[model samples]
Every structure is written in C-alpha cells, then in structure tokens.
Target: MYPTNIKMKKKDKRKVAKAVRGAIKAGIKENIKLFLNTKKFGRIILAKLHI
Candidate 1:
C-alpha cells in the first residue's frame, strides 16, 4: 500500500509538471508572436505584410 501511494504521488507530480511546462511554452509563444507583430507592423506598411 505504501509503495503504491508513493507511485501515485510521483505520477501526480509529473502530471502537474507537464501541465506547467505546456502553459509556460504557450505563454512564451504568444508573447513572442505579439512582440514580432508589434515590431514588424511598426516599421512596414500593412499592405505589404503577409502575416
């Protein structure tokens, strides 16, 4: 019973870690995209840009 409890705890920890990592990655990607769009749009005309 003790060993099974320990294994369950470890699994839970791993799941939480994976979720946190994914959220961080998504946030970083959004920030980078926003930064790039802001910088690029500031310097170029909207008509010439291609996403």
Candidate 2:
C-alpha cells in the first residue's frame, strides 16, 4: 500500500476512493468498539444526564 500515492488512472478513481473510505470506516468502527470497553461511554452518559 506504500505506493498508493502513485497516479491512478481516471477510470480507477472512484474505485480507489471507495476502497479508502471503506478502510477508514472499518478502522473507526474498530476504535469505537475498543473505546466502549473502557469507561469513555460512561462519561458521555454522565454528561448527557448533567445537561
């Protein structure tokens, strides 16, 4: 993946964008799951209650 910075053909533009978006979304999902295992979610709930 190091060479992903290389120029991609116009025909592959959408495909590459889709792949990058999919990868970023997947990474975010993983981080969210990991965070939920800690007490970060409790803080969010407490803040909501205070409001």
Best by lDDT: 2
The ten-residue window of minimal lDDT in model 2 covers 42-51
Q: What would the per-residue lDDT of candidate 2 be over residues 1-51, giving only the tens digit for each residue?
A: 466668878879989999999999999976865675477785575557653
TM-scores for all candidates: the values are 0.61, 0.55
Ten-residue region with minimum lDDT total, candidate 1 = 41-50
For 1-51, candidate 1 gives per-residue lDDT tens digits of 355534457789999999999999999977866666688663364436647
TM-score: model 1 vs. ground truth: 0.61
On the 0 to 100 scale, the lDDT of residue 31 in model 1 is 80
Measured with C-alpha atoms, the lDDT of residue 35 in candidate 1 is 69
